[model samples]
Target: MIPVQRVPVSDRTQVLLTRWTGRVRDAGGTPKAAREQWIKAQTPRKHVRTALESMTRGAVRCMYCDDSRGTDIDHFQPLENAPLRAFEWSNHLLACSYCNSNAKRSQYPVNGDGVCLLVDPCAEDPADHLRLLLKSGLYDPVDKSARGEETIRVFGLNRPDLVKGRQDAFFRACSNMRDWHRLHQDADPLADRLAQALLDSPFIDVVHAMTRLKPVAEATVVGPATIPALAAWRTAHSLSFRVGQPRVRRSAASTDCIDGVADNALASDARSGQVRTGRRNNDEPVISMQNYGLTWTDITGTPRSSAVAYDESSAQDRKADLVNDGCTNVEIVAVRPGKLPEPRG
Candidate 1:
């Protein structure tokens, strides 16, 4: 599952949520009564529903399986368990019917110490807990913690159909990455279209999987160049918006043009940052896509963003149905990437 960026609800909506929570708090009702009230009050709040859907990753697919359309606003912390948290914005997640109604329901498993065993990708990157094997499409538990295993069981993450979908997504991502690399190397404009295709595709876990499992995907799916090319594209794509309109940043390290945008611009542009004119010499001048030193404020109002060797998306322009549906899951016994919290169990 992808990391969700929770957008602040409108003041009016926030007030509505707060009022609902207040009702449960003041009623001194059983969790059942709170849940009943919640079911009644939640349906009319289309605004809340809209906000939840907008924030979920990858074409609004179920934040759990990433296979089907997300139709339910799931309480990550079940209402039956935490009635007072019923209307909390942070407690909500987008989910598909099968995952919400059938697979998970209200079952929330926790360790004996009462820490949740469920992996909430909205709260943290699932990659840190579970590594999705691109080859067979099964998840590899990262630590001794039961959270990874429990999350998979709760969500039916390894169900045959879902496994097939993830497998399909992986190969599709690889082909698209290859296509993107080719287009990008030649400065082909269609590279942007392909990037969108991958981003918009179902099962975005596959895209993130490519980044997290860099060496494996490189040797098996595409080639050595996939991640670097995608890294450059993502950098350029994100930085494009930062400079007002889409223009490449021309650091001292950069020396070229974007497509054909001119090198010189207003002095204010220079003071602010580079304005276009740094395309690689292939069609533009070759520029390193590495090390933009990205930083951002995490949800807890803490800053943990760091400069890393690699980061995140890619795909083809649907030239000829480059990706066909397929199913798979396998375990790769490899060393975990980083240190995790000590497992409770």
Candidate 2:
């Protein structure tokens, strides 16, 4: 997920929030009764939602999935779990209904040490722990941070429809950038439309990720057509040097860390057209005996929940045990070194 830039609420709204926060924190009711009441309120409180939507990217999309239009104010810290922050401005987030109610709901997991497991997009960059593989349209942990795995599992980030949405948006964003670059000078209106289309589309992170690709890597993976467009896009975002700005040469360290991991060559499939092309390195199915940053599908074969662990025996032995337990198609995937699950706090 891209880092969220939060804007401040009006002074009047801020006062109202202060008063509301006190009431909610002091309210004595059944479990989350006070929170539900606060959520359903109209006057004064409605301003909170309007203010949040303005902070969202691309047609007010969900901050979590960054796809669907946001329709709910998700409490970053669940209202039930951390009631003190119930009406606190910094504790609320813009979210889609599916992500708020279905994907996450009131489930806020913490490690043994009581550290919150879910990544707070507003407070920290998710890329610090997780990296989205643009080609695979799946997320992998940058290191062995449990927060990344927990966030992915909590959001069901690798579900099929979302992955396909990212995959489709990836190509469409490039095409939009290319079109905008070609017509920018001569056809102002059409160029503006092209740029707006790219901005309004879902999976904006995909566009941002593409623009951050290193020069040589971009040439090898993304076709040459989008190079200039990528440059313009980067300039617009203040990520690249403009005409008057001094050129700042970035080392490999800074360049790669632009999004999450360093920008490098990762493979794309042969089915790709001139838009992008590469021979994929790892595309096989894998299952682990411990949680992995690589997403795992459920028994129905749909991308969904937490990873499963088999016996820590030999690969054949693990496969045999899974088969004996009625998982005939299963294959054992060992957790590589430096990729182990983060120990619970």
Candidate 3:
């Protein structure tokens, strides 16, 4: 996962946000307050502009497209419909203009079961429900929930260019890992070796993906024993992650995050080209486990709900409400997983 690093806010920005928060609360569903907030936030320009710059620092590329560098502030929650959450610090995300405009426009999903596919960088572990199509480049939602469909639609996951980019990245990363493994076929000190192997790549997401792809029955990178087990880590933990200015959601007609599969995913396998050349040891199917931010539970057969972060009673009530709104399943990903794991040695 690409790590996310938070930029320390300047006193000027902090002061502005503090006041903005209060103003939004006071406005509380008033059209006038919402308009006033947008005007004030945009007037100086520097506040929003600088915030976008700060958030994209160390950012790899568009989180959705993974092609061009992301350069704008994205509203994690579409601001038009949920103005109350307009200025929340955690709600703003840095994104590329293509993704900001062409792909993800305020489209978030709610399932009949109350599962929201709109990933909260603060709450959800993206790897859980979503998977990047290595060949297709589109981000596919494995579960058939409203959240999944909406997120895919809004993010333009199936865009030809975007999916192709992700597919290229996957192969590039995979090729590097495979080459390293071939070189150290007889290495020792399993844990030390695994650590070094991981350190070789600056991109941890690549490492996680490689780990998931490694031959399951094989040993360490070199021997019969595999390297020490690496726990699931979120892309948000990366030092590269950042925040940006708030966005106002325009009408759905102007929405960039639209429905329908992009041409990439639908492309015939032969048309996309085969996986990059290398000795891919295993054709064995590898199963990916979802890291639901500790707050998620399997309720397929059971009716019990588990609290991931907030109070149990409130969480259930919220889940029910989300379900009522058309979310078929509700999985409350914990925003804060208590203490984050320290960087591994």
Candidate 4:
């Protein structure tokens, strides 16, 4: 996971923006002054939203679980207890709401190393710090670090449903990759196939995780089954067999052009006694892929968006997928450079 930076804003402006934190409010909801306030607060929305959308570009996924959508503004720390920093630009994130409320709600506890256990969707690499129990469907701490344990305890990693969801995602993602291999083993368009496969699992974290296991290159591409269809395909190429893995990549710190601006914006709002961050930029709330698929390409052909909309199609799409296989219980986990597993060849 990459460390998310707060977009900059002047201290005064941020304070003026926080007054619109009510559970219900939009760019145009309320008294003339309130409406104007909302619009001003949203000035930074575009920058913040753009930064987040860029992170998930090209099939990138959630750092913690299999949420490929990477939607929602996450607080690196809990907003409830950390009130002073609640509107702090650095404290905010773009994450799935499920992750923000259900899996982790103010559950950050620290250890001696000063590393937080909560899986910060914007701060730590989840894979480097933790491992998953494939058979039992549980997440295990890769080290004795305080941050790892806190992540597990806070997110309910051991929760039967959550673990089950991870396991199910793992199985489906493996199946999808295997299917891709079967269909295109001899096809020369490897990159295209790979891209499509990645898109298939917009929120697939399991596939991302498995790519790190030893003997990854062959293992991930070759399925364990000896079924006729699989056997025939492998026999033609003399392929080796093994359990499939995810395609993990070496972690790198994301460029944070939005940080300084975010901090200044938050400070300004806070000083003005604003209850929340303002829309100084056009940044919008991060919605989930489960709710909105992986790419805007399906609708707009790319990541850049001129505006945000909550149309019927978007709503229906989210509901169906959630009912089918997505998790409604979302949580955000921060990932940092050096936290991801090695990618399989």
Which is the leading candidate under TM-score?
A: 1
Stretches off by above 4 angstroms in model 1 are 42-44, 214-217, 220-345
Taking the tens digit of each residue's C-alpha lDDT, what string does model 3 give over 8-49?
333333334445656777878554565478667752234544
**lDDT of each prediction vs. the true structure?**
0.58, 0.59, 0.43, 0.42
lDDT of 4 by residue, 1-345 (tens): 222222233333333324343321443333443324434545344444444454453343443444535565555665444433333454556655566567775566776786565765443356656676554567788876555677777756577766777677666655655564554433322423453445435334444445444443334433455133333322222211111112122112222323344555555555655533323223433122111112111221222210111122433443343234323322122222112112111
Tell me which of candidates 2 and 3 scores higher on lDDT.
Answer: 2
Task: Give the lDDT of residue 99 in candidate 1.
Answer: 99
Model 2's C-alpha root-mean-square deviation from the true structure amounts to 23.8
Question: Candidate 4: how many backbone clashes?
Answer: 73
Best by lDDT: 2
Candidate 1 on 160-227: residue-level lDDT in tens?
99888888887777778778778756644366457756766798777766665555456565466566
> Which residue runs of candidate 4 sit more than 4 Å off their true CA positions?
1-40, 57-63, 68-71, 80-90, 112-115, 182-184, 188-195, 199-203, 216-345
Candidate 2 per-residue lDDT over residues 10-74, each given as its tens digit = 33344445555556656763347657657655543566676666556568899899899999888
RMSD of each: 18.7, 23.8, 20.6, 15.6
Stronger candidate by TM-score (1 vs 3): 1
Error of 1 at 197 (Å): 1.1
Predicted structure 2: lDDT: 0.59
Candidate number with the higher lDDT (1 or 3): 1
